[model samples]
Target: MLGNLFRAETSTLQDPSDELWDALCGPQSAAGKVVTADTAMRVAAVYACVRILSETVAALPFNLYQKTAKNNREVASKHPLQMLLHDLPNEEMTSMDFRTQLMAALQLRGNAFSEVERDRAGRVHGVWPINPDKVWVGRSEKTKRLSFEIHDGDMRTLTPQRMWRVAGLSTNGIIGLSPISQAREGIGLSLALEEHGARLFSNGAKPGGVLQVEGKLSDPAYARLRKSWSDRHQGGANAHRVAILEEGTKWNQIGMSSEDAQFLESRKYQRSEIASMFGVPPHMIADLEKATFSNIEHQSIQFVVYSLLPWLKRIEQSIFRDLLSPVERREYYAKHSVEGLLRGDSKSRSEFYKNLFNSGAISINDMRRLENMNSIDGGDQHWLQLAMAPITQSREPSSSGSSND
Candidate 1:
């Protein structure tokens, strides 16, 4: 049934439209650099942001959980879907590799696609990632339902059930807008600045200065003088070298302007901007200008809460919606364990665990499990402070009806 539903057709010989051609060629930024997902990643900040987000998500523990009879939830370790998601997504890739690829796609292209391969019983057996660039999303006019057109070797159509999609921020719910395409101008400017700096250094790290002479020289003499100067002191290796002046010629050095001096500052600001574009904290990408020892920990917490939480929720919900069947959805859901990212220093964590243990909120075994330590034989029992009493009991008069001597 699944094979029949997915129909493939060979492409017909036709000229591509201008829009299609432009997409194939990629967008040219104002800085003259071609800005695509692949090209944007060449920028250091862009690469760092994507790598941080993708690898962070990939390292997290993602697994399916089932609702228990006691109204709690537990990891469905034996479930086929659980094993597929937590250990391996497909034969070709481990769960981390698959998740990292999909997340990187989401960070770069604003969308990720995966084909859901099901067994004879309609249980999901494997998941295979598809390149976002090769898949086009559209709604069918007849049913008004979403469909995916995969442009691999053959043009194949996949129904919503057969294809899993995770989209980033979007104006419409169907298609996600590419961050690289939207922020091309700023990224292009960064690229241009980087290139300019490289060229400036290559030209001896100084602006072209005027050469004063006693009298006007012929064109050939001027040409010969210019070529001689360039050949002696054009590259970084020849920078700051002593020059011999003859024939009453004088070298007037040009000092760098304020704007030129601020080139490094501009590059730093652009790095911050790129980090902000991906919702990453500047300190996370090694931008510690405003970060301090006192507040860097707080910033890391903010990164997990403000930046990483939304992406985690998005992926978790998408998995629940696209991977689970209607009946399975009622009882099972997916989640990523963010405990490790949110964990504080040893002192802070010890205090936290102490408070929770005293309040009987968590058992010793639970804390051990969170710390990835082996549980003791009797660590399952929850403990509470024995001296703590209810407010009403504290307010009551003594039964002996006498004051303490």
Candidate 2:
């Protein structure tokens, strides 16, 4: 299935033009740094946000589900595409690896593409990821349908059926805008600040300070003094070393500049800003300055709701649209099980289950399944408290008491 997609039998597809390469090179930012998706990753905050989101999404239980007659859904374990999605997307990559790479690409570039390979019977067999850099999206002039031009040693055009795309937030509904491109100024500034801090420490953590002498010295003496000072104090290894002055030379120390002091604060702000841009909570990325025990759990929940849910929905909807045939779409759908992420502490979870069980909203077997425990026999029956009754219902008069009254 994979071999047929890469065969060099293409004729009409054109090579990607130089204009596309220039765009891919990315734009220069206000901080005077080029902020491409690759370069933006060098910033620690960007890397952390991407890693948190991608890993979290990849670790989730992505499964194909079938709608049952009872209005409930069950894992489509017997479906052929179920194995492709749940265990392996292709021969070369496991589900986790494939999802991680695809999600990282979506997070960084705002779009991810994979070629869907189907067997002769029109059943999906494998899915192979294509680098966003190598794929170009366009619409046909006559049909006005979306097409993807892929350049992997050979150019090939694929229709929407063969190409699966998971797009992030989009304005045009056709293509997703890259977050790295949209937030280049902030990210570039972060990269520049990081570079500046590195350079500051690389020079023995000393901004240039003046050395005083009692009298004027010759050019050779001055040169020797400068060389001697650098030899003794330069580089991070020599930082904070005590210097011995000779020949009545006095060392005048320079205080840290205002900009340097603000460097730390600026970096902190940028970290929070980048996290916000990615819809990740500050606590998730270890930015807990304002985080407290009271709100950290809520923040984590918000991360799953506000940050991860949208991305998961996009992937799920894309899977339903791209992987399943028109006939199968009505019956089968893709979903990620986020029940684990949304679970609270053990005590809280116990209370939740208790409430649901008492209300007969969930049975013992359902609770056990949620907790990943084997269900007990006859545990599927739902039960509610028999004593519970509506407030408007009056108690029935006792049969023997009616005569006594």
Off by over 4 Å in 2: 1-26, 209-227, 242-261, 390-405
Relative to the true structure, candidate 1 has a C-alpha RMSD (angstroms) of 5.4
Indicate the TM-score of model 1. Answer: 0.86
Candidate 1 local lDDT, 282-379, one digit each (tens): 98888989999989888889989998898898889998888888999999999999988878899889999999999999999999999999999999
Alpha carbon deviation, residue 20, candidate 1 (Å): 6.1
Kindly list the per-residue Cα lDDT of model 2 for residues 76-148, writing each as its tens digit.
Answer: 9999999988998899999999999999999899899999998898899999999987777766656767778
lDDT values for all models: 0.85, 0.86
- Model 2 vs. true fold: TM: 0.86
